[model samples]
Target: MGLRVSKGQSIAVRAFLSVLCLGVACFGAGCDGNDQSSEYIPENGAKIGASVADVMKDWLEDPDVPAAQRAVLERVAATGDMESLDYEQSWAQYRQCMTDLGYREIKLQKYPSGLYIEALHLAGTARQESKYEEDRAQCTAEHVEYVQAAYAMLAGNPNLYEDADEAVVDCLHRENLVAADYTASSFAEESARGEEDDYSFDIRDMKARSCLASNGHLTAFIGDDVEERLW
Candidate 1:
């Protein structure tokens, strides 16, 4: 996950909260409307819609496609709303692709929001988790690219502290809190550990918060007191 420092909130506090939320897997709880599909399609909607059409054209042309599904695709294309395409179909294809590639115990589940692939069984080993992430990335490459492009565009905005990210990294390095090239992957591993351990804040978290605060990246507050000051 990306670090989320607010305008006035210290980066240290934000890092603390980020770790806390990751530990509990509650970071996305309020993300009901934050679907990748709703991101602003920079450059008039046609480009992205066309990209989706190109990727799915072959699947749509298959004789096995249901008439109703075909109608939905046609409607989505006509309206340039690529998010309306059948995600269930794409998910099935992804699962099949992973299985064909020798992944076992791959399961998909539907929540109220959307489908999610569960590969925890595949995460038993570092190599297994790496392979699972790689294959899963391959399966969702097209969609991932589109969403990443949208986020990249958003990050390009000058108003959203685009430069601040680097500054925070620099601060962390100067304090010997993290490596110069510390990445989100580092935090992701920590988050996975937090989840497995039932969300307990640990020494690493304390050090991160302390580093941010000492570097003038955080404010003093405790527990819910910080929540009241949120932007």
Candidate 2:
């Protein structure tokens, strides 16, 4: 999955994350208190009760979806922007693409926190950190990770072979590797802190493995889950 960078906004990651947060909230609140028969309506506080796994499972079972769309969705599930599409024309184009692919009614929940996270990321990336060296360095490092991971996954797929820039490919590979190391270390630290249970530990490890397999490393841009934790 190539990350198309421009002067405007990036929506894929933000939208996916919004869905994840919404799904998590729904699952957490509804699992015990409410019945599954209770449809998750957007209003009346039902949408806020869906779980992350529930939403993810729905995406996995969607019949009309193709592998390419799923892969892209999965890649950005942690950070897809679902806020107002007013930044650029591409936001509309991407939304249209997803609708055409039949994911219009993908999630019946609304997670406002996802928008907050996206806004934070956009703000951080948008600002020139001339006064704060540490923040600037961290931001640069994070961007490198995101770009690298996307390219690494893209490179591993033969169907997405597009010849263009040698330098970009090399940079992506290098950053991907670095990201992997950092992710593994971070997981270990979190485990030590008892911040992860068996399921979460396994999920984190799987993410590390997935990134490693796709990019041969985990670049600084370690995807949405890890980034959310940072926030």
Candidate 3:
């Protein structure tokens, strides 16, 4: 048997159909091409979100910000939170603080190479000082001891070795084996190349000591136990 539509249900169905038809016509007219003056549709929430995203993208593209600062901002953005960049104004304040301390922009061509030049200059100065030479040699020796111990520990523990990446393991092995070889090869290389800048700690500390006090002896004794005086 076929289903039958009752008279009362048919009347209700006509009313509902009439309402739906009116709604469709209203929606179509409201969104017609004639409404070109409307910049956006209130029904679409995406326009506002997209505009905000574009503004943020533009801000991120600004090159004046330091690479470190940009890295942190990018990490925050990657977290999918927009509110984290509220601290950006605070970064401006921080930059002003750095500017007050004599920070300035340098060309990339002159940046790290300039740093190397300065380091070499300081190292040259340290080489001129006897006391700095001794202390730095001692510090280097202590560092080498640590390196040797690290390598010894790594060798005995193969499972421990597996935990670290190959580069790290290689570094440990190199540290263990390189010290003697480096010392030997350095002399030959220096002999062949002529004396080049060592840029060691002796020169660095001597320059620092000079800046602080005229009496290098007194400055060197700055950490001495004054309580040991019996006289």
Q: How many clashes (backbone N, Cα, C below 3 Å) per candidate?
A: 0, 30, 2
The worst-scoring run of ten residues by lDDT in candidate 2 lies at 25-34
Model 2 segments beyond 4 Å from truth? 1-62, 66-90, 94-117, 120-173, 176-186, 190-231
RMSD of 1: 16.5
- Per residue, candidate 3 scores C-alpha lDDT tens digits across 1-231 of 001111121121222112111011000111111111212112112211133223234435656544544544454445433232333333334334433433342111111101100011122244344443343234322222222112222222122222112212222223232222223233224223322233111211323222111110112222322211101
**Top of the candidates by lDDT:** 1
Each candidate's lDDT (Cα)? 0.35, 0.27, 0.24
Q: What TM-score quantifies how close candidate 3 is to the native fold?
A: 0.18
Off by over 4 Å in 3: 1-54, 82-231
Give the candidate order by descending lDDT: 1, 2, 3
Ranking of models by TM-score:
1, 2, 3
| TM-score winner, 2 or 3 | 2
Candidate 1: stretches off by over 4 Å: 1-77, 80-85, 115-119, 142-231
Q: Residue 15 in candidate 3 has what lDDT?
A: 20
lDDT of 1 by residue, 75-160 (tens): 54454343424555555665677677786534532222231223123125677656765776675543222222222212222122
lDDT of 2 by residue, 96-210 (tens): 4433433321111112111111111222232222322344233322232223223332333212212111112222233232222222234334323432232122223333223
Candidate 2 TM-score over all chains jointly: 0.19
**How many times do residue backbones clash in model 1?**
0
Q: What is the lDDT of residue 169 in candidate 1?
A: 36
